[model samples]
Target: MKTYDSISAYIEACPAEHRTLLEQLRAIIQKNVPTAQETISYGIPTFKLRGNLIHFGLAKKHIGLYPGAAAVEAFKEALGAYKTSKGAIQLPLEEELPIGLIEDILRFSVAAQTKSA
Candidate 1:
């Protein structure tokens, strides 16, 4: 599997169509969690504040957002329209990226991590 040293490198390697979406998602994460450290974890771009805040990556036909199980459950209603598993949400490439929802999730993650820390 390919490995990435940084988030930018990971985004750079993605297909052009997905690149813009990933960049926007990265920006949303950064704007919401200004102090979180960015790194590659489990082969995906991850944000760490008190701990693992969130992770995101390009999927075959969607962008996968990993915010852990609790966060997924907490936002279940808001996430109903998307595909979700235990700790991941798949935002389809064809749809307009949910910037507001992504921002809310990032904020929720930051708050949750901060409280547990």
Candidate 2:
């Protein structure tokens, strides 16, 4: 598998159609967590504040947002429309990206990370 050196590179490596959506997600994360550090972790884009805040990547049919299990559980009710696993949430590309929900998730992640730190 190919490895990306940065978030922009990772986003660029994805299919052309997914670029805009990935960029939009990146912007939402950045906007919500202004002080978080951006890096390529596990070959995907990750944000870190006190520690890892969130990671996001493009999938075949959706965008995967990894805010860890606690955040996923915390927002379970709000995320009922999307497919979620232990630590990830799948935001389908065909539907409108839930920017508000994404922002809320990011904020919750930042707060949780901060509290833990």
Candidate 3:
């Protein structure tokens, strides 16, 4: 995969149908973590605040949200039908984005990062 220097470039490389969703996701991230340092990490769009706060990007079948293991564990019960791993959540392309759940996760991430710092 090609490396991206900016989030816009990464989003641009995604399928045209996914761009709006990716942009919405980016807006949510910015709204929730206004102080975060946006950058590309692990070849994906990432937000940093002392450490890596979260990483998100488009995928073949879903948009991957890497909020690390802690967030995944904290929100596991609320995850319901979404696919999750140790540190990642896969939001399928076919479904509408869960705006409320996403906001909660983003807030939780910011709180954790703040407490740690």
TM-score of every model?
0.96, 0.96, 0.96
* Ranking of candidates on lDDT, top first: 3, 1, 2
lDDT of 1 at 31: 86
Off by over 4 Å in 2: none
Best by lDDT: 3
Report the error of model 3 at residue 25, Å. 0.3
* lDDT value for model 1: 0.90
Candidate 1 C-alpha lDDT tens digits along 3-117: 9999999999998878888998898888888899999999999999988889998889899899999889999999999999999999999988888988888888888877877
What is candidate 2's lDDT per residue for 39-64, written digit by digit as tens? 99887999989888899988899989
Q: How many residue pairs clash in model 2?
A: 0
Clashes of each: 0, 0, 0
